[model samples]
Target: MQITLMRHGKPVLAASRWLAPCEMGHWIAAYDEAGVHVDAIPPASLAAASTAVIVFASSLPRAQSSARALGHAAPRVDALFREAALPFPLWRCPRLPPFAWAALLRLAWLCGYARGADALATVRQRARAASAQLIAAAAAGPVLLVGHGIMQRLIARELRAAGWTAVSRHRSGHWGMARYRLD
Candidate 1:
């Protein structure tokens, strides 16, 4: 069976200006609410999605929109597959681009700087649970997941741990896909 963990399409939101560390909280909120550019989904990825027996999407707006772009008028929306909560750093730091804040926050989160947000351990558990669901669905046929970048990476790691092998990764920008197969 085949399984594909796909990053959602490019979001409509933009980092038009530099932001202070504190401003990133608001940016994160907007990012969570943003919809994807549906037209940007590559034809090849769309074709792959169309072949899936089941399509799943994180409950976030971006992910849900990506599923529709893949031709699934309605996909199984699962909050369990949502991206790990980004920790909002409330410390003083040099003002940087919004994307820079995102990258720094992610790095900080990895280094155990999460204040009261979703702990790293919690994310790992969710990844395992979501991975199991995909594996179960694979028994029936192909499964496609249109999810966030980091969430897709987490799921891919879980799939590899479960003995699935990587097939190919499409260079489709935000809509890129990491393919895996149980052989």
Candidate 2:
């Protein structure tokens, strides 16, 4: 059985503006609601998606839109595949661009700064469940998952632990793909 985890296409949301730490919450909300730029999807992603017998996507607009753009008109949607919640600090100074803030916040989150968001352990558990779901789906044939970068990485770890062999190097960028197969 084979399973492929693909990051969604570039989101339509603009992340170039500088923002205070406290203002990141609003940005995160907007990003969650934003869709992908269909024209920005890579041809390789489209080709990989076409080889899958089943497609899955996160409930987020970006992932769903990516699935559609890749030719899956109705991918199975599930919150289990959603990106891990990003936690923002309440500090009012040191304004940074959205991407910079996301990087710092993600590092803080990894260091145990959940700030009311789902804890890393909880997110790992979810990844394990998501991995199981994908593996089950792959029993029918190749499975394609249009998901977020971080979540895809977490799920890839779980797939590896479950005895799946990585068929390709995993990429963490938008429109990147990681392929695995159960031997």
Candidate 3:
């Protein structure tokens, strides 16, 4: 069985300004609601979306937009595939780009400061469940999942631990695909 995991297309939001911690909260909310840049989808990803027997997407707007952009019918929307929640801290530091803030906050999250989202352990459990569900679906034919970068990484790790082989690199870029095979 083949499982192709694709990151959703690039979001259409602008991140040119540095964001304060309080501003970051609003920024993340907007980011979550933003859709994808339809013109930026890679050709290979679009083709994979068309050929896969089933396409599953996170309920997030970006993933849903990407699924539709690929000329596929409405995908099975599953919150299980949602992006791991970002936990921003109230740091009294200079503002930074959204990506930079995300990097720092993720590091903080790893160090045991969950702003409020599920703990890392809980997220891991969810990944295991998501991977098992995908594996079961793959029993019939090839499957494609358009989801977020972090959750996809977690799911890929779980799949690897379960003895599945990764056929593609674990890329986190927009439209990047992670291919795995069950031998």
Q: In terms of lDDT, which candidate is strongest?
A: 2
**Candidate 1, overall lDDT?**
0.86
lDDT string, candidate 3, 105-164, tens digits: 777776777786777888889999999989999998899999998899899999999889
Off by over 4 Å in 2: none
What is the descending TM-score order? 2, 3, 1
Q: Rank the candidates by lDDT, best first.
A: 2, 3, 1
* Worst window of 10 by summed lDDT in candidate 3: 109-118
Q: In model 2, what are the clashing residue pairs, if there are any?
A: none
If both were scored by TM-score, which would come out higher, candidate 1 or candidate 2?
Answer: 2
Write the residue-wise lDDT of candidate 2 on 25-137 in tens digits.
99999999999888867778888998999999999999999999999999999999999999987889899899889999899998999995899999999999999999999
Tens-place lDDT digits, model 1, residues 81-130 = 99987887675667899888788888988888787568788888899999
lDDT (0-100) at residue 96 of candidate 3? 89
Task: Name the runs in model 1 displaced over 4 angstroms.
Answer: 170-172
